[model samples]
Each structure stands twice: as C-alpha cells, then as structure tokens.
Target: MTQVKLANNQWGYISAVIDEASNEVVSLNVSNHANKQQLATTLSNLQATIPKESMPILHSDQGWQY
Candidate 1:
C-alpha cells in the first residue's frame, strides 16, 4: 500500500494494492465533503482495479483513511 496527498485540503485519501502478486492500484480518493453517492464510485474504482486472484496483504501506515 502507498499514500498520495490530494490537491484538495481536508479532502484526502490513501491508495492500497496487492503488491506482491501484481502491482494493483487501490486508490481511496476521499473528501471532507464526500457523500454516500461519491463513496460508491470510489469503492467501485478500487474493487474494479484489484486483481481477483492476487491476495497480497494490504499494508500501510495509520493513515486517516486506512
């Protein structure tokens, strides 16, 4: 897992992935003003990108999003 800061303030996210099996990218793009509608797409993006058989243990710091 890895993290990248968003240009927007108070609005942040952490990206995680199955690194060993594949360089999958799981980006949790979040915002302080995010709502339920936004959440679905964000989660969907992560789910869609992850490799189905790649179960690499997700790792990350104690990020506010993670």
Candidate 2:
C-alpha cells in the first residue's frame, strides 16, 4: 500500500497484488481512501484472473488494510 499526490494535491491510495514467482502484477486498485473496499476490489479482480482449481496463498505485511 502507498499514497500518491494527485494533480490537485489531493491524495490517492494504491493497492496491488503481485505474483511472487514471476514478479508480475496480478491486480491493482486505486482509490481516494485506503479502505476495505479498495482492497476487496483488488482481490476480486485477482479472483477473476486466477483459475478456480488453483488455491493461491497470500502474504502481506499484516498491515491494517490486510
């Protein structure tokens, strides 16, 4: 998770999921607030791309968002 300064000097939050083995980005979401909805959307997007049979493990820093 990270924050960026938008053009109007407002803040935007970014949430991303990366494929550890390939160093590829699986899903990414940006929002004005770093909340559950943003994280949920990121995971939802990843769910669509991954195969149903594959059960992937998620590792995070255990931050509040996670």
Candidate 3:
C-alpha cells in the first residue's frame, strides 16, 4: 500500500485487486489509513465478485498493510 496526496494535502491509502492476466482492476478500497482492515475490505469485495472455484492466488509483499 502507498499514500496518495490529494489536492488539499490530505493523504489516503488505496488497496486494489487487479487481474494480471486481463490487465484490469477487479476491486478497490480506499481509506485514510493503510491497515489490515483496509486490505480485508478490498479482498472481500474482490471475493464477492469472483467465483470461489476460480479464485486466483493472492500475493503481497512485506508491507504491513498486506
């Protein structure tokens, strides 16, 4: 996760799930803070839209938000 600065200097974080094969964004969640809950929300949204049997392997780095 990374911080995004707005026009007013407010910072927010965005977690997004992308379909690498399709090069498309499948899900997105934005919050003022980057944390486990934010990541969970993004993943939950993605799960709701994708089929369980076709679920892709999720990957993450060493970031705490991941």
| Highest TM-score against the true fold, candidate | 2
| TM-score per candidate, chains pooled | 0.38, 0.90, 0.84
Provide the RMSD of all predictions against the true structure, rounded to 1 decimal.
5.1, 1.2, 1.5
Model 1: ten consecutive residues of lowest lDDT? 9-18
Per-residue lDDT of candidate 2, residues 1-66 (tens digit) = 889999999999999999999999999999999999999999999999999899899999946898
List ranges where model 2 is wrong by over 4 Å. none
Q: Model 3 TM-score? A: 0.84
Against the reference, the lDDT scores of all candidates come to 0.50, 0.92, 0.84
Q: Which structure is stronger by lDDT: 1 or 3? A: 3
lDDT of 1 by residue, 1-66 (tens): 133456664444333333444565455554444345445566577677768996645455644443
What TM-score would candidate 1 get against the native? 0.38
| Winner on lDDT (1 vs 2) | 2
Instruction: Looking at model 3, report the run of 10 residues with the lowest lDDT sum.
Output: 55-64
Candidate 3's residue-wise lDDT over 1-66, tens digit each? 768898889999888878878989999988998888998899889999898689488877737766
Ranking by lDDT: 2, 3, 1
Local error of candidate 1 at 60, Å? 1.2
